[model samples]
Target: MATPRPARAARVLLPALVAAALLGGCSTTVTGTAAPDPAPRPTEGVGADPVAWGDQVCGALLSYYQPLSARPDYAGADLPGIKDRLSGYLGNVRTGIDTGKQQLADAGASPVSGGDQFRTSIEDLLNRTGTTIDEARADVDQADPNDVPGFQERLQAAEEKLRTIGAAEGLDQLGATPRLDKAIAEAPRCGELDALTAPS
Candidate 1:
């Protein structure tokens, strides 16, 4: 019985030794098919979370548009963008008023008609905007007493459009950055709102 046990042990040892030797020999035997290492974790698009991008986009638009509406005569080719350009945007508003004035000049003293009425209204708005801004200098003057409702109505419509913009095209079509940037640059809210307010 002891001899049989030894023989059995030897048989097990012999196979294991042979297997070890085979392992050392490069390509001495073929391995059965293996499952293969899990595909390397994907590296593409690792840091592009849409929600995070959306928030960044939202914040940037808010910052950009905050002061734009105040200045309506802001018609320039583009912005300097070297410095903060807070004044540059104000310049745009100035340009918008200037452009309106230039058009009025070109019209050569024609009494205001259809579109002209809207233009005149805008000129008046430019003046009112200055007064409105002065009123906001202190909380006691939270809003301009007279222009408050008008100003609020204008900005409110704009804000409503801006608020819905992210949801409308979806973060997908415009994407986070460009979409947000587009809303700021084009001021779509102001576009439609202004058009509606303009002559029929």
Candidate 2:
């Protein structure tokens, strides 16, 4: 089946949505001047070494979306080519999530309170998102030309669910820590994903 063309919004927003989930709801605000070579600066948040840890995790996720943001057209001129590209895109997203999970574990960054719960929640969320992306890719691959609308509906629904989860977890509130927030804002690649996806 031929894959349906995505709307302008979807084309722009999809990468940002995935990037946000991978960042554990980190803010997309870019502030200050990014260092020519910004290393993760140490930050003191609710947990031990939360800043450094968050930086590492968020950085990894953002890096994945950075290249996508640079692409003028995620969907190429050919429909079949677009489907193939999307398959590769989903695979990359899944790999990034897996790598981010490993980085989080290795960094041992946990909140001061409910550390285990927090870590579990994050891991579960990442895993679920990866699974959903896999499903979306399958749907894309198998979609008939007439099935494009349905596929789009399902994809949007999945994205909405992810947004709800992030909000419920107060990911945007991570900016409460001024220093950490600043660090995140100043990170060179922090807002790149969102910038590309945001509506003009």
Candidate 3:
């Protein structure tokens, strides 16, 4: 017996896919001094338990991403400052992702129903996200005003890849869970990203 091609691809490309999704750019102008926190919602539904668990994971992600989204334009800023800020932002994101994965594991949530794919996906995503963050920092260090267009292009590409993967993986369908759906919808920073990448 042989594994189906889609299964093989999912196994082989899971890391890359999750990484692309995590790195996908969701640009929004953050306002106010503080970002909104994830609110508590009732856990009720077919997958209510997992949905609740996933909310925590998503909350962790939003905390980091929301702040990063709020940061002023890094283009043409002091190179050293931009690099340092981006480095810090990436560090926070790394931490959040790790914590989110741990939370998911603790709750025994799986990307696929009754499968261990979520854990593997999170680990792979963390590793790749770290690398991407480093690369982004490097780009910042080397960036000039002329680099804006190229940088935007890269961001768009990453975002598109994430959107495609999310759709293929049925992440969009997860939004059917009321609580998780509301959390994502109300999230200040990740709202657009979640909408664009995850299924509605």
Candidate 4:
């Protein structure tokens, strides 16, 4: 071991070092920082931002409805603004689901069960959000977005499902927190219907 220190060949070493330098910027090269976004990473794509959308919708709902809650007769006053915002946000998220579908395809993946979970959950969200928008619009059109307990229940369920999907990576790995979170939000929303309004 002491006799053989091994020879350093600059001939081999220079080319290896040059090769590393060359490949560093090569198309086929990989780096620790960038593993490549096999599927485009974006909110409307794989990084669906439904939870943020829900939170915004909730904030809007709470802003409009809470005041209306105290004065049911004046509920129609808050209709136009809430309806416009809700419709726009829901429309945007619907587009997001469509974008996500394309992303899955681009990633060389098919519509699997996990994708179904995300799809179904988002579709449910779209429906419920649409219902809220309708309820809000009904306030402007026929009536007001007043004490509609049933609509609230649907909205809350949609919110919960969105949260679950947001917290979990996807459907297949929807673990305890996601499920429990959904349960917690959903149960209370459903129960509120019984005591609040009979509008179903």
Candidate 5:
């Protein structure tokens, strides 16, 4: 069987890959199908239960990620078609990032100690990813579709920027705090994240 185009075209487009980092998974494999939406988790403020708090955090990130990974495939398409599809994919990514940020804000301050730091780290990662994707989208918009070499070069540059998505510090610290570690491990929604990132 052939490799999925989204994985083949750009691994950065997969939210499961990013979620692996967020949920403390060491690695991930891209699947062509999008993971099912996690059950409706509370959108309100953090609760005393660390598991509940973890659910809120995981929910916010997964909400947008579900749609973000359903990227358009450009395999075998002409240059013009490829350009359009690629641009659309990036635009969707930007929209997903915006939605995730707002959702995180709405989820309010974390109840667990050091949770705020963890949340901030995620926000920083999203900010950096958003900036890089936005820049790449802009470049794609200006690229001449007829110029195959130039378009390919632009895609390569975008891929390079995206390869650095999960390098944020707080992610590595997910296991550092026992409270958070338990929450992330036991949260219902977080379990979904684990399933999505697990090799399939």
Candidate 6:
């Protein structure tokens, strides 16, 4: 008996189609165009744009210092009143620490040489201040109206701590970093920061 024509064609065409499909599956799709290269990261020694970095740093600092800018006066308040104001003040400082940490992190690594060290020191300072503030708040919470002298003393101590808790230290750090100092001086946002913290 003669081989069926359709069967013979199927044997021939099936393998060819399978092979073509397999090859197509293995082939990569082409767009006839090359993709753009990614941007290069700054090298270890290389710094970021000084003015831009300064702007970021100053902006972050400003936000960090905002909560403490205007302190609540507890001048004539009695023990309970004083405690309330003091607690509120310490709470603001705590909030400032939280705000500042986020801002600093958002500011990212310093672009100038030795900037990282300055950033680290500032962060450490903030952390320490936060711990101190927490302790002060606890003291305020536990203060006894019966012990007038002790309560006043604690309040005085907390006020002293607040006086030292503002943005001067961060400015001093900037001064230590000469390049950053210059950059910050040139940064417009830093100018706003200066005005905000300036003696009124």
The candidate that wins on TM-score is 5
List residue ranges in candidate 3 displaced over 4 A: 1-48, 72-77, 110-124, 138-200
lDDT agreement with native, every candidate: 0.28, 0.45, 0.39, 0.31, 0.58, 0.53
Model 4 C-alpha lDDT per residue in residues 1-200, reported as the tens digit of each score? 00000111212322332232222200111112322223322445322432332223223223322222231122233433443443344344444434433433343321111223443443453345444434433432332345455434434443333332211123334322332222223333222322232222
Which pairs clash in model 6?
none
TM-score of each candidate structure, all chains considered together:
0.23, 0.50, 0.40, 0.27, 0.70, 0.60
Sorted on lDDT, best first, the list reads: 5, 6, 2, 3, 4, 1
lDDT (tens digit, per residue) of candidate 6 on 102-179: 766766666665456555665776676677678767866777777987766665555444444432234343323445
Question: Is 3 or 4 the stronger prediction by TM-score?
Answer: 3
lDDT of 1: 0.28
Model 6 per-residue lDDT at 94: 83
Candidate 4 local Cα displacement, residue 135, angstroms:
14
Q: Each prediction's Cα RMSD?
A: 33.9, 11.1, 13.6, 25.8, 10.9, 29.8
What TM-score does candidate 2 get on C-alpha atoms? 0.50
Instruction: Write model 5 residue lDDT over 93-190, tens digit each, in one string.
Output: 78877887886786666665556767777678668878977887776677676786776666666556666555345554443355555566677776
Work out candidate 2's RMSD over C-alphas. Answer: 11.1
Greater TM-score among 2 and 6 belongs to 6
lDDT of 4 at 51: 32
Point to the candidate with the largest lDDT: 5
lDDT per residue, candidate 2, 1-200, as tens digits? 01001122334456564443322222344343333322242255423454454455444444444433432244333444445565566677667667767755664644322333334554665666666666766755664435556645544554554343221143432322334445444434334433433458
Give the per-residue lDDT digits (tens) of candidate 3, residues 66-147. Answer: 4334433445545344445554654555565566556545544332231233334444554555455455445444544356
lDDT of 1 by residue, 1-200 (tens): 00000011212322332232222201112122333322232233311322232232223222222334442232341222211132344344344434534433333211211222222443354444433323322212232324544434433332332222111111222212322232223333333333322322
Cα RMSD for candidate 5?
10.9
Pairs that collide, model 3? 172-199
